[model samples]
Target: MSLPSYQKAAVIEGTELVIKKNAFIPSFEKNEVLVKVIAASVNPTDWKHIDYGSGKTQGSVSGCDYAGIIVSMGEEVEAKGDLNLGDHVYGVVHGSSLERRNNGAFAEFVAASPLVLIKAAKPLKTIAKGQENIPSGPVETFEGASTLGVALTTIAITFSYYFKFDFSKKPLEDDFLLIWGGSSSVGQIALQFAKIYGIKVIVVASAKNHHHLKSLGADHLVDYHDADAVEQIKALGKNHIKFGFDTISLPQTNQKVHSAVSENATTNSLLPFNPKDLEDYRSDVDITVTLAYLAWGKNTKVPFPWMETDENGAAVSNPGFPEACKTFFKVASKALNEGSVKHIPITVLPKGLNSLNEAFDLLRHDKISSGKLTVRIEDSA
Candidate 1:
């Protein structure tokens, strides 16, 4: 297959993302693979990078989750024998990142590291026009596949590495996991993974989303808007909630989630928070944050101040995270192939890269809920 020298992409211009019709097609490094991006999904972090972080510069491409075909591979990737050209794959990338400026998923082609990529068990099914909100189950559509990369990586690391769960053994029946923002993309997937491991789940979400979350295996649902939301979680879990994940991670949400957990329980957040802020709430509880970009095993620069950085302001590398992610990806692949895992439903935005502006507006204003915003690259043309 012939590769193009230039392609259309969503590029950062000032504080907003703009469609560039002639952005350079990035070259792959020795440890990377060049992919022809078929579909990409919008993540909160994609907009946050531009709004809250200084990492993205003008002309940097914008996005993270993508499902596509491998068009070319580096020598190291080829020698590994784990992936190949024409293989359908989905994975996360640090879009609009300071480290990899032009290699974002919202483009015609992307240069991605093979370590963070997952080979799909089957080819991605094309979604028909006006049927974007397909029923959620397994990995099938490119739109659905695009939503899995970021959520899966975060769940894999949160469970296997941070929580230190032994996948060989099922969790005890008494064990409970609390998930804040249960209607969000990450929260929904976390609910499923926790159930698959035999752990009961308590979800905090809107009242309208309870039925959907219940279907996804949430044992208990607490409406976050309720005045007694935290107390509800505490009562439902019988104050024995041993694990908690705050997908929303606002300071208020963190406090509520922390307050709901039992003493000595472990809680993880999507964004970094100062321990002092939560010290008044619960000192006995352990609090940590997960950055999925660390699974790439590279130094990163995140917007939050809680992230550790060197004199150059780059985050330190976690040498062990990449291998841990590799192991967990195998586990995830098995679960996906067995149809035990479900991808989040998505709303396909028209005009591909051109639709990103609207997508960002919807996400920024919190107009979207319970589903991801996706774009088919072919629609750009």
Candidate 2:
């Protein structure tokens, strides 16, 4: 296929998103695949990069969470599995990393590690008795699958990677988990994964979302707006909740989560918090932060399912992250097909990539609630 030398992408211009028509389409590395982005979802991370200008340099493309078709692959991808050119996939990339100038997903094409891309699976809907059935195409629309990568990957690391929870076993009847801000994209999916992994969960969110979250498998609900939100959770679980995840990661919510879990429990927060900011919590309670891009950069020490230690007992480089991401993506894709994982509601913007600035502004000003903001990119194919 003859590809374009220049592609359209959204880049940060001071505090706004500038759609550049002549952005370069990133080339793939040895272990990477180049995707023709069909749908791209905007996350809070995108706006944070725009507003704070952290980890960004001149000409860095904006946005992440993409669903697309594999237009090309490096030499190594064929040996990995069924992945190939023209397969539809969705996953996360370090879209705004300054380390790679052409890193972001907002562009018409993106080069992502094969480890981060999950081959999209469509579910079977036909019911024929006493006969074999075959499903066709992706069960999720491009926009629906677009919502999975960042939210699912981060929460997976929080529980499966950081907390070291075993996903192979079913949740014990007595086991309880507590999550704050349960209606957020990460929170909602986290609730689904925890439930499917065999743990009962208590969640704190707005009362209006209570019924919706409960349907997603949250066992107990506490309204965050209620004055006794912590007390309500603590009273119901009574030190039974051992694992805590704070998706909101606000100072007040952190303290409340501290009071809601068991004495020796560990908690994971989406955003990092300084130790001083959490002094009110008991010293015995361990709090760790989960960053979705930990495996993307070269210099990170985040643990993956496949990392190994050197002879000196120091953790070696992230050779296994690609495999780890590939493994988790398969698990998540299965969950999605079987209805164990549900896609969050999304609000799609018009005008393709040009609508990113307005979409990001919705997140920046808190105009969005519960649903994710997505932009359907015009397929250059």
Candidate 3:
């Protein structure tokens, strides 16, 4: 198949998104693959980059999660035999990145590192005509597959590496895992992963989402609006929560989650927060921040200024994160294939690339909740 020289993309222009019909089709590096993007999803970071990322470059594509087919690959990727041309895969790219300006998932085609990509167990099933939303289930559509990349990578690194969960042993009856922001994409996926590992899950989400979250494996649910939410989590888990993940990761949510877990619990946050800010909260808990972009195994600058960086402003690389992503992709793939893991529910947007501006607006104002917003590439035409 002949590849196009240019493609339509949602490009960043100084804190705003512009749909560009003549964006260059990015070329792949030796360790990367060029994907023909089928569908792409909006993430909080997508809007955050435009809103708060001072380092973001103009003309960079503006999205992260994508589901697509491998249209081309470099020699190294082809030789590795792990990924191949025409394989259906879902993964993330550093969208609106300051360094890799042109490579982002919101375009018709993307140059993405293969290390963080996950091959779909089966071919993507097309969404029926006029269908706007896909209910949660095994990943059978590109929209559903598009939501898994960032969420899965975060969970993989958090559970397998940072938290050091021993999946080999059966979870004890008293073992518990606490997830704040349970209705968010990452929190929803984490609930299923914990259930598969036999750990009890206490998730904090709106009461209205409890029925859906419970179906996804949440053992207990506490509404974050309640004044005694932390106490409720503590009571339900009996103070035996061994692991905690804060998908919201704001200082207040972090403090609440910190207080709800066991005294010596290992906790992770999606966003970086200073331990000093939480000095009065607890001293014995272990807290680490997980940035999914590190799974690319590249030295890059993080958008947040508070994060640790080198003299050059590049965030420190985690040498083991890429390997951890590869390892966890295998586990997640197996679960997805066996129908044990379900993708987050998704709402497909209209007019494809043109809808990205609206998507970003929704994300920017926190209008989207309990599901993801996605766009199909073919619809852009």
Candidate 4:
């Protein structure tokens, strides 16, 4: 069980972590798992946390998603359930665990909580349920599976309650929904999820990404390029739409959502569905969509099942979030294995132990989008 002296790892090294070589590889608790990272993907949270302290701090690393082979697992963890030594796996972290206090996935090996790392085989179980189009094979390579983490949070955290979406049905002539930043990683998956949920989507995003949104099944696309993006949106609703998710968390996005759902919304805003507070009666439409911001103040202004807050000023857990995550990953795994979703075509840059910085530079310039960047570190099998 000898280890290399200098494994590849992307280190934040300090505030504004600029990737450098010689970062550390983390060790695990008894039940913890050590992943020989196969292909780690850079997500927005990865950069934001590195640049902005948006996630719980470890020491240097700030990435969160990875796909790879398991080299080690805590004794208790191995005895507890399904994970086996040498198994390939992928998952997202809880964001606040000290085990990962500043440790993120931008490295060759990450010691992660067993709870966060689901056995890769689980998602493949859905094929037997008659979910056609899913391949009857191991879930495709890591990046394809790597992108599922944030998408899982968006769906599980923000829209689990609304999962009752009857995709087979059509929206009424006046039904509407406000989707902020439809082009984002989280928004993309949510749109795909929403398609199954039956919402008439009015998506907000940069004009260039509108086509991508349309491909994901957005009903209407609003270019955020214009100063009056919200105004344009509200006019389309003529004030009828309510319900939204602010994946972007921008000040303007907040206002746009408030307007799109508040102006002329016809769903009883006064009584309040979850009944937390009331006064500004968009009274017609009680529900307004907002992404549960982990960085902002809690929104108790209007009530719906989705709103929640924790002591850390983060959105409290949604009731069905964990389950939704499990389900979506299962779906994503199936899609990946079966080829329903194509991996964003790109080079598999398995750069061993020193390429972490290179990955970060590419991400910083917005050089990677729609395509994935990856790294591999172990031959556990």
Whole-model lDDT per candidate? 0.85, 0.73, 0.86, 0.54
Q: Candidates' TM-scores?
A: 0.96, 0.87, 0.96, 0.66
- Tens-place lDDT per residue, model 3, 1-381, is 799899888888876788788989988898889999999998988888877887456778888899999999998998989988889999888888888778888899988777777788789976876899788889888888898888988988898888776566677889899999999999999889888888999999999899999999888899999999988988898879988999999889988888889878989998888777774667789988898877766668866674767788888768788877877777788888788899888899988888888888887788877999999988885
lDDT of 1 by residue, 231-339 (tens): 7888899868999999999999988888889878999998988877874567778887888988877777765454777777777668667866877788778887778
Q: Quick one: ranking by lDDT, best first?
A: 3, 1, 2, 4
Tens-digit per-residue lDDT, 79-142, candidate 4: 8866777777776643312334434566667776554354565432111212212211234556
lDDT of 2 by residue, 116-192 (tens): 56676652221222322211123366776777778877875677666766676665577688989898889988888
Q: Which ten contiguous residues of candidate 2 have the minimum total lDDT?
A: 126-135
After superposition, candidate 4 runs with Cα above 4 Å error: 1-7, 15-25, 29-32, 54-58, 74-81, 94-99, 113-139, 161-176, 235-242, 262-338, 341-381
Q: Report the Cα lDDT for candidate 1.
A: 0.85
Q: In candidate 3, which residue pairs get closer than 3 Å at backbone N, Cα or C atoms, i.e. clash?
A: none
Q: What shift in Å separates residue 208 of candidate 2 from its native position after superposition?
A: 1.2
Q: On a 0 to 1 TM-score scale, where does candidate 2 land against the true structure?
A: 0.87
Candidate 4, number of clashes: 23
